[model samples]
Target: MPQKKLPRLRGMDNVREDEELEQFGDSASLFVRDAININFTSAGRAELRQEMKLATDQALRCLWQSPLHKDCFAALGSYWCKVDAETWQIEQLIECGPGDVFHIVLNNMICMACDEGLFVYDGSQAKRLTIDTPAKPNATDAGDGSLPASDYSLAISWVANGLESALSEIDQVSLSKNSSINLQFPMCLDPNVSHVRVYMTEPGGGELQQAIELNIATRSVMIANLPELGRAAQFQYLSPMKTGNFLREWRGRLWAVRSNVLYFSEAMSYHLTDERYNFIQFPQRIRFIEPVDGGIWVGLADHVAFLRGQDVRSMSIERKASRAPMYGSSTLLHSDMIKELSQGGTWCAVWLAENGFVSGTAEGQLVELQYKSIKGISAESCQLVGFADRLVSVVN
Candidate 1:
């Protein structure tokens, strides 16, 4: 008598209902039309998945867990939670309402994204990421200065801590010959602002050049003489990144995605983005962007493209044959932590795709896990959270 081997299961696929799927336990496998109330572990053991008691009346969406502390953060209907993962303790609760929210934790900084705008929580309070620009300056002809008679425009930007905000509205003024313009700037309502960077046009409509940097408390400045103008105000070509989805940090720069455009911040700077020169456009919509050791894994609409280079501008895109990734379904998994559960787990980015779960290694090699027996064909979006402790795949 021969020993009987059971049939192994590959993930579900309803698209090819008429075609026979892979069968057998070794080289091929079969798929269930639907997997209900059970999950199979890596050793091919089917464990019962039961519904447990809810801690809260409602559910938490867009959940993110911190690896260092093992705590979790989630968004309730209109609130935010700081939870202890092991004990499931709601340590802190915040009231942040009315829009879809996404959370990101970079080092000590934890930021939340919503329809209203972007905000950062400093372990206590969540503050919106905005700094008011100093208002247009009021100009008068009643001044004794070296400013010659010329029509000029003055632009100013606010600086909080070391972050320089977007340039303010330009205020134009006509100066009579030998007469100076006395400019007075209104007090900025944003308390975080500490300094103001001002730029002015030269006589006879010259280029806007760096004029002077004054403390925010200094309301008035007499344009006595234009000293050697510093560097040109090239920052005028840039804008602040107020809101974006898929916010990620890569190579000392902030990367965000909107539509089909991937916008990048200045090196080591987060607030400012030069969209004209600091963006990568794709024909298809971007689902996720994950920064890896030597490159990035970009999940596009219907394919997965690996960018193979440290420099984003020069990175080469290598598209492979694979099922499309679901929207916003990517999560970071550590090799050491994953090794406890399964095999061949490296420090790579994992995302749910139409076929199954796709993992992109830092070396730009792609390995897909298609034996999960989950149907991703009909799912428009999937929720992947707490991958370190437990893999929660909620098809939405």
Candidate 2:
């Protein structure tokens, strides 16, 4: 057979395959590479001329920036190393055991949840906050009324006909104070009592009434815009249900979640108790919860919910009746996969979805970023971290 003359290829467009034409379609500034490292410029452009390489061969599991130490922490394999922000040098901090998860940072303390226990690191030392075995409280003696009270105590007494009755003990108490008071209790307290009563007392006349306006929890109580009660304010220790798996501080309150239940402590309180905190149940397991804008964003197995209210006591499952469902059957990978970044002046939460990636705003807006380049990549193999002006995603 005679050879037929073929047209000379002039450019990529002339020789492009059907898939390449569909993916790159008429775009001049688009580029794709199997492995390419690029730097983001101050002018908001990706400078692809320079390439970089990883210092280690281990897979990167998680990445976090510590404002206290001015460095970045990277969890690779079973080891956590600190990357110096100025020199970009990596220093191994500790070798974590299997199933160890780094939770959050509060008060310059790094919190981690592991199979062993809850650990907190204060820059230099790591200590586990032990959840002691709950002790059983003995029945009150009928005659003597002598019970060794906890390090904290709360009592109430009634006065009638100018006669004062003996004070009766209560589990929880809320008091009004003009100044900020720190309520401290033993880390290990009996977990039997569930509810505590708070009383607002008039300092001058010794008049007391049940405090309905004050926010009190098992670990702390916050009283605002009220006069000092001197020595009249008191509280007794009480045990609440077991703590949840995930903990985060949001809107002046501590939020904990386990399975499908979400619990929030009282305003400005860190104590997690049934009486001091309220819980909302969701249809699916809550995978992530984080503070966004001025409220909270909860990521469930199949949906996302936003919570913003003045009082945590009033938050219920009914408030989440309008949750936005995820695309198809996609779900979040892990709680730590969610990252909140500032886009323009508003805050946006980005997470790794089972399909690709998704972003949501505090205003109940969700956008799925299923770019053609990342469409079919396994979600578990993708890790995302937000820097000052850019989002870096690594695929293994």
Candidate 3:
């Protein structure tokens, strides 16, 4: 056949797939899987490099900026250390076990939960919180136990006896004038027999006396007319049957979650009393609870929820519909994954999901960043930390 002039191909822009592809350039931001390095002035995508190195042999568990020391604290396998000017300074704050999990920060201290018990650590020292519990009655003793437990009054007394055994002591509990104290039990307490006893020490080495106007309830106690300035006040109440796994401070209150129940401490006080605290139950097992934006983001076993102003709303990514109480994708998130669940900015928070990464804004918008180039990145294996303008994620 006679030779015909062929049209010249300007560039390989239309080649979507190529086996022999080499150099590529585009004005749009490109996501890639492989790592590369280009000229600093060139607008090309490149793999992230390690900006700073941590000096430690043990695996790093968590990192946070300490407001007191004005440095970063790294929680390694068995101990924690302070990182300043890129130098890892080991600190013997607390001996953490395998199951130990750092909970939250309050009053310039960090709270940790471990198999032994709950512990609090300042920059210099660590103290294990004493869990006050009343003596358990002997089950075999049958004086009142032999009587029929059917009469209403007798039933009430029996309940009181049971509560006496379950009483938990509140240590170092203090209150201000006209303020209330909230107590959180490990489990719900019986309102019939549960009551709070507040012991206040008078000024100048005076005797300790119980305060009045106590409002007792199932899980909390409220005491009004607290002395303005007493030597100190202590509280005791029925012990909680269970201890919470996580603790955080939000909206002027201390929050703790055990299983599906959420407990709130009295406003502006850390004391959890039967009359002072409130609770909310969820349908599914709670995986994580964090304060995001001005509200709280609750990650359930299958989905996520948002609580704001006494109202709770479920979030899903499937529903693109606007004007809903919560706005987000309906993608199923991995509940067990606990990495980078914190605020990314003033308006948004970042967290890991089953498939990829996600971010939720204060306006109730959830976004998924699942670029194919970064598909191999596992959120579960990464520890995320936020800085002024960037987020640093360390992968295992």
Q: Cα lDDT of all candidates, in order?
A: 0.72, 0.46, 0.44
Scored against the true structure, residue 240 in model 2 reaches a CA lDDT of 25
Reference-based TM-score of each model: 0.76, 0.52, 0.52
Candidate RMSDs in order: 5.0, 12.2, 13.5
The weakest ten consecutive residues by lDDT in model 2 span: 136-145
Error of 1 at 90 (Å): 6.6
Q: After superposition, how far is residue 80 of candidate 2 from its true place, in Å?
A: 8.3
Q: lDDT tens string, model 3, 112-210?
A: 554445556766666554333432211111222222222110000112312222233323332222233333323424333444333433322244444
* Model 1 pairs whose backbones collide: 22-29, 146-224
In model 2, which residue pairs have backbone atoms overlapping below 3 Å?
153-235, 154-235, 172-196, 172-197, 173-197, 173-198, 174-198, 191-239
Candidate 3: where is the Cα deviation over 4 Å? 1-30, 33-54, 71-89, 129-246, 257-263, 271-279, 310-345, 369-382, 394-396
Point to the candidate with the largest TM-score. Answer: 1
Sorting all predicted structures by TM-score, with the top scorer first, yields 1, 2, 3
Worst 10-residue stretch by lDDT in candidate 1? Answer: 337-346
